[model samples]
Target: MNGAGTKRRIGIGIVGCGGIAQSHAAALKRLEQAGECTVVGCADLVEEKAKGLAEKFELPSWYADARRLIDRPDVEAITVCTNPPFHVPATLMAAERGKHTIVEKPMTMDLAEADRAIEATRKANVRFGVIFMRRFWPGAQRARKAIDDGKLGDRLILGDCILKWTRRQAYYRDPWRGTWAGENGAALVNQAVHALDMFLWLMAPAGQLETVYGKWANLTHPYIEAEDNAVAALRWANGALGVLSVSISTDPQLGARITVTGDKGATVSVTEHPEGRFGLNDVWTIPGEEEEMGRLYERELQEGREHFKPFPIAHFWQLQDFLAAIREGRDPLVTGEEGRRSIELIEAIRLSTESGAEVKLPLRTSTWVPPTRR
Candidate 1:
């Protein structure tokens, strides 16, 4: 029990031993070192992979099958770090066994799976959360605060999410990297979803999502089936018109940036460079309000520097939030439902591309159309 007055250490397990699992293992190690939790178990389809990560993280046990890890008596909670295809199954196994579950992003391949995961966790009476760590960034937090507090004025006039991350052809060499079925959609669904999630967060997900138009191109990497770039124009629920441009095609990979403009002629923007790591390179605030907001941003930086490792500090922050929510017996900061909204939005964008027409929200088409050559 990590509740306010309790000191019980939560025993946690890592379900997949892939590349991203390393980050989760490192985070759990940090928590273990702080006396907050322990990494008791690890699992992967490849026995060697599981064994290697367990040895690396100093975890006590490893399993070739996820069920073995889930069925373990000591694992009170589990983080589903499996590939996108396995997210739901892994999480369902954990929740049904009465273990709190944390799922990685894109929650599931689509909204239906996401809803099922949410319902199953609810029925099992276990806490459920999704990893969208970018939401925990300091500049993002301040921007959200300003919007909620009306510092950005009553209406958002414009918003743009520009994510230009680079990946060589070698990056997609894995079977899952650029495949339609294995990795789901291309740039919009894979790389840009995080930025899109941020856009939806700063805006809000409910209400009518209108005028969604998108086009995807395979510009580079002819060996792969998925598009390297995509552009979408849409109207957010709040009636804020915006454009989201994402690509892994850029040569140098520009920073992931989000700029929101309000009716009051004020704009709040945050640009984070891939090389610069987690801290924002530019947290542009309205001129007169900088003294007040800059202090707030500085405080976030100070706390982050004090409590976190240099790289991927946001993951640790979000993981702490999940633990605290479990302890308090409350919903996590980013619930499964909240995480699904971004997938829903992206799916709508894809559906628009497929039909070559503007699609409506609560997308009627459940079909997934992978980005392929024309």
Candidate 2:
């Protein structure tokens, strides 16, 4: 309905009013300024929270039920910023309403939910995209280019490295901060998803994941259903391997990073952190592929675009891309199936932790239990 005339601005609704919703609202405002979108309304179980964001963004309306927001006449696109549990229902709601979507990553808690949502989107013929912004970072771009350019040589292994980060006793005091039903899986699902997604994308592994071995503990913060610490091993389809190291118990907070190794060399990585009030900074470091990396970095620097690279780049890039798909009619860079694959891999890793065995990739779970918000 956005293309009513010539290049009409898109109408977007926000389906969650939590902390992440603020970012989506801000991003929507930026898109509005760029003449790409118009913020129509937002919804939250907490009515005041929805009203506050609506007032802050000067949105035309607000709702308590996400289904209501998705059903609005003016909203042609939607950003689902709810916690993990709400992803699938909200996704189906948007698709059923015929609106485009930009849902946040890890996509959902289980592979089953992801599968259903992705299939529904496919059936609806809508432009559904996920938020895997690390792939957009200047450094990530350089790394991807290096791999694509054969500078990194045949893909080898991607070491998924991340320091356990800042969730103190006080941080989990909210009650829902550290729980399984609330936050779902441990460090792997909540914290390292960004890195996991980046690793898979960069390595470009050919084979399905052969196995995963994992361990988890309340080693630090104990008030949660999920583990505060965890580690895993991944053997890729192409015989490439990955090491997953992360813990939520690392006090004082640290950044998440990844090192992708190829036939040629290694590429050090930096996960983008929130920068001031503007954006994020996800950086990449390819040890020897500096020439190509330098060219891309220098070009961005000259463009005076130190705006948020990586995550936020993917933010703007995907938003624009989804909008373009909505307008010109194209497929998104990261499709629903791609998003589902990440969930399936996550399920495999989680299964490894529970079953104490190597779970295969394209993890089949006829017994996969979907999340039901209690």
Candidate 3:
């Protein structure tokens, strides 16, 4: 027990010593200072990378094999930071060891894997979560509340998600970067998945998405095996319609935006300008609060600039929620099922793109394959 009360610091292990793991490590360090958790070890398939992350974070141990890290009795929980393909296996390993687990998003490559991971954790009786950190942003929460409070009106008529970000050729040079075998899909599944998740989250009140029609192309980066641009049209059960467009081929990197409009003629939107910065409520037209949009934007922008360094503080907030869930014996804010929703939506779009037909939702099966590019 590290804290003053009966509470104890949760023992944490980290799998995958990659760039994303650095953010988890930094957040864990802050949690450790608050007496919330202890980072006992880290692991990666490459021994040198494991050792490097261990030394950098001053964790107690490092291992080339993740199983060794998960088997440690002190590691009560672990964060699976591996790439999409490895996410399911790592989650299963942690669950088998009776350790609480949280995985980085897209959650798993597809619906089948996501289902397996969810079932494994449920059987093992361990808490599980997925990192969709943007949901922890205050602005996002405010937007959700506005919808729940019916401030956006009775019927959400239109929703749109636009992600125009840039990535260099060097980014695809990695063996796994632009491959169907490694990443499953490119712009839609890899980079724009975050925006897609945010889009789905904000539009949930509109009712379930009924169908999707999509198209994908490798236009700019012909050297890569995956598409660098994609677009989708969505229809909800409640009659709300949506458009989603994502691309990494843009020259200036315009970031992402998710906007929703209701029947009463009010609209609200969140924008992540320049991509990696925090999302702010850029457009708010809910009655008298119209004039407050500028103030709110500037205020949130300054807060994000101050707190986003050493990695986005959103990670810290979400990780804290995971740890609290572990101690309270409850599910995390972003549960495995919640995370699976985004993967399901992504898979629907991919299937529509492959068949050149509108895909009906609650996808009957996960047999859809990525479209082969020449």
lDDT of each: 0.78, 0.69, 0.88
Task: Provide C-alpha RMSD values for all models, in order.
Answer: 2.9, 4.2, 2.0
Best of the candidates, TM-score: 3
Mark the regions of model 3 whose C-alpha exceeds 4 Å error after superposition. 1-7, 371-374
Which parts of model 2 have CA positions greater than 4 angstroms off? 1-6, 251-253, 266-314, 366-374
Error of 3 at 254 (Å): 0.8
Error of 3 at 80 (Å): 0.9
Residue range with the least summed lDDT across 10 consecutive positions in model 2: 273-282
Predicted candidate 1 versus true structure: per-residue lDDT over 65-146, tens digit per residue: 9998889888888998887899888888888899999988878767778888899999998999989888888778877777
> Clashes in each model (backbone N, CA, C under 3 Å)?
0, 5, 0
**Candidate achieving the largest lDDT:** 3
User: Candidate 1 versus the native: TM-score?
Assistant: 0.91
Candidate 2 TM-score to native: 0.85
